[model samples]
Target: MRIWVVLAASALGLAGASRVAAQRALGKLLFFEPALSVNGKRSCASCHRPEKAFTDHRGTPRALRFAGNLRRNSPTILNAAGQTSFFHDGRASSLDAVIEAVLTSPDEFGSSYAQAAQRLGSSAEYRQLFRRAFAAPVAANTINAALVAYLRAQTATASPYDRARAGGPALPATPAAGAALFAGAGGCAGCHGGPQFRDGQRHEVAAGQWVKTPTLRNVAVTMPYRADGGAATLAAVLTDGYHRPLPPRPLTAPEVEQLTAFLEALTDTTSADHRAPAALPRMRDLPGRAVGGQY
Candidate 1:
C-alpha cells in the first residue's frame, strides 16, 4: 500500500513538471510568433533580438515597430522578471499588462486580445500547443500567462562578476579595482545597489523626467544607454546623461575606464547565446527615424 502511494505521488509530480514544461515551450513559441501582430510580420523577438542581448541596436535609440518608432530605447528583457515596474516610465504594472498594451497599441502589434486569439487560433499547431500548455481554449489571458512564464525564465545572472562575488574566483585586477570604485568613491552603489545592481526606484535625472532605475546586470552589451538612448556609450552615461549636480565626486577618465571594465565583467555570455531565438526575417523595410524623448 505504501509503495502504491509513493508511485501515485511520483506520477502526479511528473505530470505537474510536464505541464510546466509544455507551458514554457508554448510561451517561447508565442513570443517569437509574428501572427499576433496585424501585419503578421513583427514578433516580440523582432525588436528584442536575442543575439543583441534582448535589445535592438540596429536603430537609433528606439526600435522601429510595425506602426512607427518606439518613443524610447528598447530595454533588455534579460533579468526583467526581477523588476517591479515595466517600461522606462513604469507605465505598466505587470508583464501581462505590458503584453496587452503591446498587442493593442497601434504603434505595436495593432491588434486587440480577441484579434490576436483569433489569429493564433486559426493555426491548428498553435491550438494544440495552447491546449497542452494551459489545458484550456486559446484565449488572451492564457496567451499572456504563457508569454510571461517564458519571460520569467529569461535570466542572466551567471556572469564573471557574479562568480567573483560568490567567491568562486577572484576577478582580474582591473575589474576588481573598478568594482571597488563602484561601491566606494564612485557612489554608484547609491543608485545601482543590491545584487541586481539597481535600487528599483524611479528618480528624476533631469527636469520633469522621472525614470526607473535600470539594472546593470549586462550593462556591457545593453548599450545606447539611458531611458531615451541618448547616451550612446557607457562613458556618455557616466558623464552628461546622469542627473545634474553629479554623484558628489566626479569620475576621471581612468576611473570611467575602470568602471567600464567592471561593467564588462558582468556579461553573461552563456545566457546570451543560449536564450537567443531563431532568426526571423524582417517584416517591413521602413527606415527607422530618430525620436526625441527623455529616459
Candidate 2:
C-alpha cells in the first residue's frame, strides 16, 4: 500500500512537471510569433534577439520597435526575473505589465490585447498549444503569463564567477583584484552587491534622471552601457559614468582592465547564449501595414 501511494505521488509530480513544460513551450512559440504585432513583422524576439544576449546589437542607441526607436538602450532580458522593476525608468511594476505596455505601445507591436488574441486565435496551431498549456481558450492573461514564465526560465547564473563563489574554482589574479575593488573602494557593491548583482531599486544619476540598477550578471555581453547607450564600452562606463557620480577615487588603466576582466568572468557561457527554438512557427504578414520604428 505504501509503494502504491509513493507511485501515485510520483505520477502526480510528473504530471505537474509536464504541464509546466507545455506552458513554457507555448510561451516560446508566442514570444517568437510576429503575428502578435500589428504589422505581423515584429515580435518580442525581434528586438530582443536571442543571439545578442537577448538585446538588439545593431548598434542603435535605442531598441528599434516596429513603430520607432525607444528612448533608452535595450537592456538584456537575461537574468531579468531577478529584477523587481521593469524598463529603464522602472515604470512597469511586473513582467506582465511590461508585456501589456509593449503590446499596445505605438512604437512596439502596436496591437491591442484583443487584437493579438484574435490574430493568434486564428492560428489553429496556437489555439491547440494554448488549450494544452492552459486548459482554456486564448486570452491576454494567459498570453502574458506564458511569456513571463518563459522569460523567468531564462536565468543566467552559471558563470565562472558563480563557480568561484561556490568554491569550485578560483578566479584569476586580475579578476580577483577587480572583485575586491568592486566591493571595496569602487562603491559598485553598494548597488550591484548581492547575488544577481542588483539592488532591485531605482536611483537618480546622470543629469537627475531616474534609472533602475541593472544586473551585472552578464555585463560582458550587454555593452553600450547606461540608460542612453551613451558609453561605448565597459571601460568608458566605469571611468566616465560610474566614476562621475561618486567621489574622486579614480580607476587607473590597469585597474580598468582588471575590472573589465572581472566583468567578463560574469558572462554565462551556458544558458545566457541565445538560440531561436527550432519549432517556432512562421508569422503571417498583414498587407499594407506600416511598421513604426521610433519611440
Candidate 3:
C-alpha cells in the first residue's frame, strides 16, 4: 500500500546534496512551504498534490497566479525522483536548478531568488532547518536546493507490477494482463521502459497526436490530458491524441481497457491525503535531455 523511494546511497555533493537525511529533513518541509512561491498560496503541493501522486488532479492546463497558461501538462511528482530530467522539454538538470527555474518562471510562481530569500529566508523554522541541513544560513539557493532535495525524495509507488518483477506471489490477473499488454503489443514498454518506466525522452504524436507521454505510476489523477491540455481524461487523450501529431490515434476498445487496467494498477493511495478514484482517466511522446536534470 505504501512504499518510500530508496536512493542508491550515492552522494550528490558536499552540502545539500541528493537524498541525504539532513537535506531531506528540511526539503520535506520546504516541499509544502508556500512561502517559497511568488504567492504564499501556491506551494509545490498546490499542483503536485501529495495524495494525487503529486500532480494537479484538474484536467486542464492550470494557470499560475497572474501568469498565462503554461505550455505542457503538469507531470507527476511520483517516481519523478528516478527520472533523468524534468518536464516535457527536459530543460532543467539538477533538482535544485529545477526549483530555481520554477520559482522564477513567469507561468509558475513568478518569483525571483531575491523574493524567495526575502520571504522564506526570514522564517525561524526554515532558518533552523537550513542550519541543520547544510550548516549554512537560509538563503534562496539553499532554500531551492532543499525543496529540490525534498522532491527527489518523493519516489515511485511499488505495485503488483513491481512485485511480479521481483518474483512476488499471486496478483490480480487483469493487472498482470495489463502489465504484459503495456510492455508488449501496446508499445508502452517502448518509451516507458526500465523499472521506473520512462526513457526520459520526449516525443510528439506520430502522425496526428497531441500531448506528451507522462509516467504510468499515478495515472488515476491528472485529467484533461495533453501538452496543450485540450482533453480531460486519460481516455480522451488516448482516443483523441491531443493534436500534436496531426489527428487523433484512436485506440481499440479492448486495447484501451488493457492499458487502463495496467496503469491503474500502478496507483498508490498511501501518499495521497485524499485518494483519486481507482478509475483510469486518460493518456503522449516527445524528445530531449538537458541541464539541471530531475529524478
Candidate 4:
C-alpha cells in the first residue's frame, strides 16, 4: 500500500507537469497567431518581438488596418509578469484587462473577445489544444488564461549585474561606477527601485501629466525610451524626453557614459523563450506572419 501511494503521487505530479506544458504550447501558438486580429495581419508578437528583447524596436507601432499609430512606445514584455500596472498610461488595472483592451482596441487586434473565440473555435487544432489544456471549449476566458499563463512564465533570469550581486565576478569598472551613480548621485533609484527596477506607481514628469514607472530589467535593448518613445538614446533619455528633472547636479558626459553602462548591464534574455514557432494554428484564410511581424 505504501508503494502504491507513492506511485500514485508521482503519477499525479507528472500529469500536472504535462498539463502545464500543453497549456504553455497552446499559449505560444495563440501569442503568434495573427488570425486573432480582425485583419489577420498582426499578433501579440508583432509589437513584442522576442529577439529584440521582446520589443518591436519601434517608437510607436502602427495601428490596426493602418489606422494611424499608437500613442506610446511598445514596452518589453520581459519580466513584466508581475508588474502592478500595465501600459504607459497605466489604463489597465490588471494583465487580463490589458489583453482585453488589445483585443478590442481599433488600433490593436481590432476584434472583440467573442469574435476571437468564435474564430479560434472554428480551428479544430486550436479546439483540441484548448480542451487538452483547459478541459473546456475554446472561449474568451480560457484564451485569456492561456496568454496570462504564458506571459507570467516570462520572468527574468540573472544578468551580469545580478550575478555580480550574488557574489559572482564583480561588474567591470565602467559599469561598477555607473551602478554607484545610479544608487547615489544620479538618483535613478528614487523611481527605478526594487528587484524589477520600478516603483509600480505613476509620477508627474513635468507638470500635471503622469506616466507609469517602467521596469529597467531590459532597458538597454528596449530603446527609444520614455512613454512616448521620444528619447532616441540612453544619453537622450537622461538629458531630455519624459522624465522628472534630474538631480540639481547634472550628470556630466562621463557620468552619463557610466550610467549607460550600468543600464546595459541589466539586460538578461534567458528567462523567456524568444524563438518563434515554425507555424501557427491551422486557420483558414490566415497565413502566418513573419517570426515576429512584417512591420
TM-score of 2: 0.87
> Please, what are the lDDT tens digits per residue for candidate 2 over residues 7-57?
323433656877677777777777777667776767787767777788776
Compose the digit string of candidate 1's lDDT tens values, residues 1-295: 1332343234336568786677777777777777677666677877677778888774333322433467778888888886778988898788877888888878777778787787767667677877777666778777887787788878898999988879899999888999999999888899999988998889897889999989998888978888777777787887774632466767888888888899999899586334533432222321221111011
Model 3 stretches astray by more than 4 angstroms: 1-19, 66-68, 206-212, 242-251, 271-295
Instruction: Please name the candidate that would achieve the greatest TM-score relative to the true structure.
Output: 4
**What does candidate 4's lDDT look like per residue over 45-100, in tens digits?**
98888888888788898887777889989999888877778999788887778888
TM-score of each: 0.85, 0.87, 0.75, 0.91
Best by lDDT: 4
In order, the Cα lDDT scores of the candidates are 0.73, 0.74, 0.58, 0.81
Relative to the unseen true structure, what is the C-alpha lDDT of residue 237 in candidate 4, on a scale of 0 to 100?
A: 86
Candidate 3 to truth, TM? 0.75
How far is each candidate from the true structure, as Cα RMSD in Å? 7.7, 6.3, 10.5, 5.7
User: Model 3 lDDT vs. the true structure?
Assistant: 0.58
> Model 2 residue 213 lDDT?
88
Residue 129 lDDT, candidate 1, scale 0-100: 77
Q: Is candidate 1 or candidate 2 better by lDDT?
A: 2
Report the C-alpha lDDT of model 3 over 3-49, residue by residue, as the tens digit: 11112122334533432677766666666655555555565666676
